[model samples]
Target: MKKIEAYIRHEAFEPIRLELLELGFPSLTISEVKGSGRQKGITERYRGAELTNWLRPKVKLECVVASGDVQTVVDAILKHARTGSIGDGKVFVLPVEEAYRIRTGESGEETLQAHPGVAQAAS
Candidate 1:
């Protein structure tokens, strides 16, 4: 199994989620996070005073997916989240050693499938 982590602009979350659902991958975990990338931070002007916003508000998406579904899922996120601008965010895919559903006692891929992000993986 694979784990997909994507850091995206907060404003893009809804579109991204709905796109994923439309693609037949309906489950995901979303968390509000603060982070900065190569841009390091951003400059802001408040009441004529300039300040640095070191950590930008972002939405983190975590999806546990079958290995075969990794690329498709990543593509969905990238496509839906892109704004052709800075802070578009990043996506990471990792090998998940194991997964277990606490309530149902399901294990491995079954556990991942149960996650909201994979309601109906593309065959």
Candidate 2:
């Protein structure tokens, strides 16, 4: 198993999410975050005062998938998250030692698949 963490623009969330779901990766986590990269930050005028935000707003998307599905999930994120510009964000794939479903006490890959009834209810 592997954990994929992607930092993406706020506007890119919906599309990337839909793409992931369409690709059968419906179970994932998201968080509102602020970060800085090559694009630096932004400067704007507020009340006629120059204000610079060192950390830009971002969306952090995380999901654990089977090792075999790593590349596919990464590709989907890239396809939907890219804006052809700096601050497009980053994606990191890491090794996952193990995973367990708290509700069923199921471990390994079985815990990664979305439950059929839950998937249906989500739709």
Candidate 3:
């Protein structure tokens, strides 16, 4: 198992989600986040004043999938999130030792398949 985490531009979240769904990856997590990368934030105006170094709003996406699905999930994110500009975001993949479904007390691959209509990683 693997966990894929991505920090992406706020506006790109919807497109990324849709693409992931189309790829049969429907179980995921999303959160509103604030950070800066090489762009190092940007300047904005507020109440007739210039605000510098303001954090940029981003969307953080997390998904745990079977090992074979990692590449497909990563590709979907990249395809939908790229905007040909700085602050586009980054993706990270990490090891997942185990997974379980709380509702049904299912473990491992069974837990993943526990969700209706959700595709499980091919073991």
Candidate 4:
């Protein structure tokens, strides 16, 4: 199994999410985060005062998928998240040993698949 972590611009979240669902990989965890990358940070005027080195608001998306589905998921994210600008964000893939669904007692890849016995494609 693999875990996909993507840090994307806040504005790109909805499109990426819709694309993921369309690709039949819907299980995901999202968080609102503030971070900076190569661009470091951006400056903004607040009450006539310039604020420098401020962390930008970003959306952190996390999902676990079968090893075979890693590239597909990554591609979907990239397709929907690009904005032809800096701070487009980054995607990271890591090995996931296992996953278990507490309520259903489903484990391994099953834990990442859709519930209600619906076998989703690319899961």
Candidate 5:
């Protein structure tokens, strides 16, 4: 099993999530985050005041999936998240030793299948 973590632009979160659903990945966790990359933040105007060095808001998505699904999941994120613009975001794949479902006392693949949008996470 593995964990796919994607950090994406805040505005792109909804679209990305929808795309992921369409790709057969419904289980996901989203978090509101703030950071900067090459763009190093942006400029904005609010109440006639110009904002600089702003920490742009971003969305972090976490999901655990089978090894085979890793590429598919990553593709979904990159295909939808890419805008050829700065601060589009990044994706990281990490090793997940185990998983379990608390509700039914299921372990491994069953645990992942119990998640929101998934069939299984593989053994």
Candidate 6:
């Protein structure tokens, strides 16, 4: 198993999410975040004052998937998140030692599967 963490432009979330769903990855976590990268931040005028916000808003998308499906998930994120610009964000894949489904006490890859009878694409 692997955990995929993607930091993406805020505007890119919906499209990436829809694509993931279409690819049969319906379970994931999302969070609004702020950070600085090569793009730095932005300057804005508020009340006629120049404000330099050093942390730009971003969306963090996380999901755990079967090791074999890592590339597929990463590709989907890349396809939808790229804008040919800086601050396009980054994706990281890391090893997952274990996972457990609290409701059923299920562990390992089976815990990553869709609930009971829901159809899921083969990994």
Clashes of each: 4, 0, 0, 0, 1, 0
What residue pairs are clashing in model 3? none
Model 5, range 83-109, lDDT digits (tens) per residue? Answer: 998888899999999888877787886
lDDT of 6 by residue, 54-95 (tens): 998999999999999999999999999999999999999999
Off by over 4 Å in 1: 114-123
Error of 1 at 12 (Å): 1.8
Clash-forming residue pairs, model 1: 26-116, 27-116, 27-117, 28-117
Worst 10 residues of 3 by lDDT: 114-123
Question: Candidate 3's error at 19, in angstroms?
Answer: 1.7
lDDT of 1: 0.84
Specify the highest-TM-score model's number.
2
Using lDDT, give the best candidate's number. 2
Model 2, runs deviating above 4 Å: 117-123
TM-scores of the candidates in the order shown: 0.83, 0.92, 0.86, 0.86, 0.81, 0.91
Indicate whether candidate 1 or candidate 6 has the larger lDDT: 6
Tens digits of per-residue lDDT for model 3, 1-33: 899999998888888888777677778899999
lDDT value, residue 8 of candidate 3: 95
lDDT of 2 by residue, 20-121 (tens): 777788988999999888988689999999998989999999999999999999999999899899999999999999998999899999999976665455
Candidate 4: where is the Cα deviation over 4 Å?
A: 116-123
Give every collision pair in model 4: none
At residue 45, what lDDT does model 5 achieve?
Answer: 90
What are the RMSDs of all candidates, in order?
3.8, 1.4, 4.1, 3.2, 4.6, 3.1
Rank list by lDDT:
2, 6, 4, 1, 3, 5
User: Clashing residue pairs, candidate 2?
Assistant: none
